[model samples]
Target: MGNEDAVRDSLLIRGGFATLLSFLLGSTMWSATHPDDGSAQLVFLSSLAFGLVAAYGLTRPTMMSLPKRATWMLILTVLWAVLAFQEPTAHYMIVALFALYLYRLPLWWGVAATAVVMLLGSGIGVVVMGSDVSVVVGPVMAGLVAIAVAVIVEEVFMVGEDRRELIDELIFTRSQLAESEREAGVVAERQRVAHEIHDTVAQGLSSIQMLLYAAERDIPDDSPARDRIEVARKVAAENLRDTRAIIAALQPRALQGGTLADALRRLATASHENVPGLSVEVTVGHRSDSGALALGTLEVSLPIMVKSVLLRIAQSAMANVRHHSGATTAQITVVADLSAGLVEMEVIDDGRGFDVPGALVGASGRAQGGHIGLMTMRQRAASIGGTVEFGSAPGRGTVVRTSAPLEGHRLESQHP
Candidate 1:
C-alpha cells in the first residue's frame, strides 16, 4: 500500500512538472518567432533552466530545512517574473507559481507575492509591449479566479487533518475495548465453572455424607454394614473437601482478594489520582440495612467482570476527557436501582463534547480516531445486556450513561 501511494504521488509530481515545463518552453518559442522584434532565445533558455532547478529545490520534502526552501522560492520567483516579461507563454508558468506560493508561504505573504507577480505581468504587457486594455483586466480576473481555487484547496486540507485526528483516537479506543471484552469473557468462564462445582459436586458430596451417617447409626456396632457405613462417611467428607478446593481454584483471580464491591469503590475514588486540576467525585446509589453504602461495605453478587469493565469504561472516558476535552471536573455515579431492575453507571465530564447521533453508533470501526470511545462503551455494555447512551455538543459537556439489569445479568460469586 505504501509503495503504491509513493508511485501515485511520483506520477502526479512528474505530470505537473511536465505541464509547467511545456508552458514555459512554448512561451520561449512564441517570443523567439516574434514578427517585429528580434528575440533573444538564449537568455530565455538560461532563465528557464535556473527556474526549473529552483522549483525542484523548493518542492523537496517538508523535512528539508526551511532556509533551503526559502532560498529556492526566492530564486524561482525572480526568474519566473523575469521570464514572464520576455515570453508571453511564461504567463502560464506564473499561474502555476501562484499555487505553490499559497501552499508554501504564510497567508499574507503568499497572497502578496502572487498578486505582485500578476501585476508585474500585466504592467509589462501594457507598458513595454504597447498592448491594449485587455492585458489589464485579464490578469486581475485570472488572479481572483486562482485565489478562489487556492482558498478551497486549503479548506479541503484542513478537513483532511480533522478526519485524521478522529481516526487516531478511534483506533486507541477500539484496542482498549477489545482487551476489556476478552478479559470479561475469561472471568465469566471461570465463574461458570465455579457455579457448576457448587451446584453439583458439592451438593452430591453433602448428601452422601448425611446418608452414610444415618446408615452407620442404624446398623449395630459388630455388623459389617456399620463398618462400611463409617468408612463411606469418611470418604465422602474427604471427597467434599477436595471438590471445594477445586472450586476455589476455579474462581476468577480478580475476585480472590476482595469482592466486586471493593473493586467498584476503588474504581470510583481512584479516577482522578493521575490527572491534576481535574477533580472527580464518586457517589453510590445503593445502601445496606445498617445505612452503609453497599459498594465497598458489603459483598454483592456482582460479577467481577462487570466491575472490571465498568472501571475500564470509566478510565477510557476519562482518558478521552484529558486527550480531547478541556474539562476541569468529572463525576462518576453508580446506582443499582433494584426496584427498577437496573444498575445504572454514569460518567459526566465538563469537556468539549461531540455530536452523538442516534442508537449509540459504536465506533465507526475505522481504526483511526472518530468517536470510538463512546462506541466501545456501548458495545461492552450491550454484550452483558446493558444499554449505553452518549450526549454531547460542541461547547456543552459530555455525558456517558450505561445500565445493566440487576437479576437478568448477574453472575454467581465464588463464595455464594
Candidate 2:
C-alpha cells in the first residue's frame, strides 16, 4: 500500500481500539452503578450501539463517496452526544468528537463541535454530581485539549503534504528545462555542420565543375589534350562522389539501425568506388554487447556529430592516398567494446608515405592557406578526451588510429 493508505489504516486501527475500550469502560461503569435498573440497561444498549457504529465507520472503504460517509458520521455524532447527556457518561461524546477530527471536518464545524461537546459534558457533570466542581471542569478541559491537539496535528500534516507536492513540481520543471537545452544544442551543431560543408566540400565541387567545363571547351576531340581533359573529367567525377558521400555521412541517415557501423561501411564502399585502383576494406566489431559512449569519452558521442567527424577523417585519408600515397589498398576498422569501455577506429593505407616531419613543416607553412582539416581533427579528438595518432615514414605506409573511452567513465564517476 501507498504511504497515505498506510497512514489512514494506522489511524483507523487506533480509532477502532480506542472506541472498543471506551465502550467496555462505559458499560462496566453503568453495570456497577445500577445493576437491575432500566437506565443501566439503556446505557448498556447505547454503548453497544456506539461501538458497532464506530467500528463500521473505521472499517468503511476509504474510496467510497465522501459526502455519503460524512453525512452518516455527522448523524451518528449527534445521536451519541444526545444519548450521552441522558446516561451521564461522557464516553460516547468523546468518541463522537474524535470522529469529527479523524474525518477531517471543516475548521468552523470542528470548533463549533468542540464548544458544544465541552458545554454539554460540563453541564451534565455539574447536574449529576452537584458537589464536585472538579468533575465538570476536568471533562470540559480534556475535551478542549483533545480538539486543540487534533487541529494542530491536522495542520502540520497538511503543511508537510503541500511542501512535498511543491518539491515534485520543481523536479518536473527542471527535467523539462534540461530537455529543451539538449534540443537547442542539436540545432546549433547542425548549423555548424552546414557552414563547414558550404565552406569546404561545396566550394571544392564548384571549382572542379568549372575546371572540367573549361577543359572541355579548350581540348580538341582527338588531341593529346583531350586525354588530359578526360583525366580531369574523371577527377571531377571522383570529387563529386566524395562530396555526396560527405553530405550523406554528415547527415547520417544510417544511424536509424542504432549503430555507426552501417554508416562507416557506406563511407568505405563509396570511397572504393570513387578512387580507381584503390581497394577499401572495412571491419566493424560486434556492437550487440556494446553500451553507448558518453560525450566526454568522444566529442562526437551524439550520432550526428560522430558521423560528421568520421566522414571528414575518411575523406581526408582517402584524398591523401589518391594524391600523395600512390596506394593500391586501404583498410578501415571500427571497434566498439563496452566491457573495455573503448571505441577504436583505424585507417591503414599501403601507400608511398612521405616524411612526417616534412609534411608537418609543409602543413605549418601552408597553415595560413587554410590547412585546417588535420588541425580540426586533432581538436575534435581532444575535445572528447580521445587521442589521435598519425604514423608514417618516407617508405613505410601510413596508419591513423583514434581511440575514445566509451560509457563516459569520467563523467559518470564524477556525478554527485
Task: Give the whole-model CA lDDT for all candidates, comma-separated.
Answer: 0.66, 0.61
The ten-residue window of minimal lDDT in model 1 covers: 1-10
Residues 1-416 of candidate 1: C-alpha lDDT, one tens digit per residue: 23322332364654675567666666666666675465665545756675566557535644445566566667776776676676665666666677656655655666787798788778876764567777777777777777887677667666776677667656576577678678778767877787678789898998899888888888888997887788889998999998877766665553455544454446545555656667777665664445445562223455545655666667667777777778888887876664565667788989878767632443554333536666777677877788887778878999888887666344335443
Q: After superposition, how far is residue 19 of candidate 1 from its true place, in Å?
A: 5.4
- TM-score for all predictions? 0.67, 0.49
Clashing pairs in 1: 166-369, 166-370, 167-368, 167-369, 168-368, 168-369, 169-369, 170-369, 362-375, 363-375
Please identify model 2 stretches exceeding 4 Å from their true place.
1-38, 61-64, 91-96, 221-416
* lDDT, candidate 2, 158-270, per-residue tens: 77766665565445445644643464366347646854774677777767778878878887788878777778878877877776566444453544343465666676787
Residue 155 CA displacement from its true place in model 2, Å: 2.7
**Measured by TM-score, how close is model 1 to the native structure?**
0.67
Best TM-score goes to which candidate? 1
